[model samples]
Target: MPSKIPDVVAPGTLARGEQPVIPVPGDLVIRPWVLADAGAVYKAFQDPLLQRWHARVADSESEARGWIEEWRASWADEHNAYWAIAAAGSDEVVGRIALKSVVLADGQAEVAYWTMPEARRRGVASRALTALAGWAFDEVGLHRLELTHSTANEASCRVALRNGFATEGTKRSAGPHEDGWHDMHLHARIKGDGPTALV
Candidate 1:
């Protein structure tokens, strides 16, 4: 039997066009990842904070290249969308952001991001997240976006809150870190929640 409600975003919406480069405030842009960004990606994963929070590390530039290729392929698969946060006129990757675990039928995805050590304290993550959220809601027509982070990650919580993703609740021992399991905070924003601060 068919369900009463239809898909919030129909299939083929993402595949209909190439992923776009979204511009944000502070002269940064959220653009698709490319092979040339491998070195920066490899280096970013080496940061102690990033490795601890994300629970993964790029062992080499080759591994980073493979990761980039996978991100590109996911665009075609419509399962995920990843972008590099960089300056307007340069390819240097100052950060990374993505819409992961996309469920087109439900019009929802989980947002994730990490900034390079050199870019911390400069609003890079929050600014890029605002831009990506705008594109996800306005351009992709997603109905909701959600994000999760270890409750200990106060910086991530700030970024999510700053971007309009309201804190929903905490899930105990939901995330694994270098230290051990961590309580995770769940945050979400719906399409009707209105524009985020920098959107």
Candidate 2:
């Protein structure tokens, strides 16, 4: 075990400090979730499309609050990082984004996101992803960031591409949705990949 490279990102890199609010283009800020956002979280899960792909719905505001608590705990544990995508100076959540399954030693993590119905088609996903990717690469020293979405989700594919995450390949039945297991399109971006912008 000693004959290996050191951790690309130090262990305390994230857990040692509070998750900072990240400002993205389009007047949106990615910030930590609060209990007050429970209603919005519940409503988001009720969206048919969200439920279709994510395969779970918040049964009550209390459950949504629990989800928020879990998100906060994830940051403390340094296993995952989640943020609420909201308008600047507003608490209303327009979307959500996260660096999932973070592996500090490997300098890699999976990205996941979703936008509210009102926030769709407004570049929220792309802009938020760009900001998150920047933070992961520049601030956290992560080397590789992966994005995977159902092959059938054209919108998500476009978001990935717009953020400079190149199409790596497809994973057969890699994601479970309300409909069933679905093939997934895997996209990835590595550090020094060059500027990330809307394509």
Candidate 3:
């Protein structure tokens, strides 16, 4: 028989800012999603800057609500895990971090993230990514986690590089994003028994 998958089931909070959200720094908290977060997610995705990089476009309020509804449902499933990024003092969501599709055959998983336009350039994404990746590797026992970002997004590339995710290669026409085709830079890191730092 096989063992169970590791998760952050322990009762410690991931900190951010002065207030308690996740105890993570940089005024942000990366924690599991809840029904209360739906409104925040919808509002954050409405930002023009975020919509530019996201794969799906939400032109109407109902569409955004529907997306959040789906995300909420998916988060409840074991195969898909999601963490809402929120301001430490308030429940207002600033972004999200996720680990999905844990493939047992290859022992691999895909990582994804996003942040509000106002939250940019504050080391929020980098720190949150490192913390989340560390937790995933340590708790989930995933051998390797992969991430892909548009080549044009320099900020995202820096975050991946800072998190110790080495670039494997580029995928031509990998994503149907702006500018017809987007060159996605693939990055990955390995999990081990001992401790390590991505920064």
Candidate 4:
């Protein structure tokens, strides 16, 4: 990964506009995933809670590999930014946060995140979301970031609210989960709100 921060956009600013761009929370570094990370990400995604909540169930190792490779390609594409999260002291990936389906004209993006079961309750997801949202606003030139969680997911709701993402409403039968079609709580955050003060 490059030691220097790549040019990203700030919140409220249009990507098409002429403004100096830089990564936010500059210390919160992100890098492309190497092939070695496949195992860790696979294991993390396979966790029952994450699998059910994230709706990520691959048919086989080949499918998982394809997904990981696609994630790698997204880093270079700029339209999708998926990061393997690590704290300052550790190289082991504890979680992942992504800016997905970005629309430059709309200044909007969808955010998704998950933390390893062993790393839960340690504020890993909260920290990563804070840093990622700050970057999205400060450098990605995105004004709005949206997230969705199953209504039963209290922890994710807390993370979203703490990050200043307003709970917009529920989307009934929005999607299917391990149980069945579930209502989803939609949440959103804007650029100027700063980080969610939880932690």
Higher-ranked by TM-score: 2 or 4: 2
Task: In model 2, state the lDDT of residue 69.
Answer: 95
Question: How much does candidate 4 score in TM-score?
Answer: 0.80
lDDT of 2 by residue, 1-199 (tens): 4837788988888999999999898788999999899999999999989887897779999999999999989998888999999999666799999999999888999999999999999898988998999999998899999999999999999899888899999999889887789999999999988535663
Residue-level lDDT of model 4, residues 1-199, one tens digit each, is: 7536433443324324332222224233344555667777778877888887866776656676787788766655557767777544455767777888877656788999888899899777777787777766766567889999889999999999988899899999886887899899999997787654856
- Output candidate 2 Cα RMSD: 1.2
Cα lDDT, model 4, residue 117: 90
lDDT of 4: 0.73
Task: Return whichever of 1 and 4 wins on lDDT.
Answer: 1
15: Cα error in model 3, Å: 24
lDDT of each: 0.90, 0.91, 0.69, 0.73
Report clash pairs, candidate 3: 14-22, 14-23, 14-24, 15-22, 15-23, 15-24, 16-23, 16-24
Candidate ranking (lDDT, best to worst): 2, 1, 4, 3
lDDT tens digits by residue: candidate 3, 64-129? 667666665664344556677877778677778877785544557788888877777777777788
Q: Which candidate, 1 or 4, would have the higher TM-score against the true structure? A: 1
For every model in order, what is the number of clashing pairs?
Answer: 0, 0, 8, 8
Please, what is the TM-score per model?
A: 0.96, 0.96, 0.78, 0.80
**In candidate 1, what are the lDDT values of residues 130-181, reduced to their tens digit?**
8888888888899999999999999999888888899999999999888999
Off by over 4 Å in 2: none
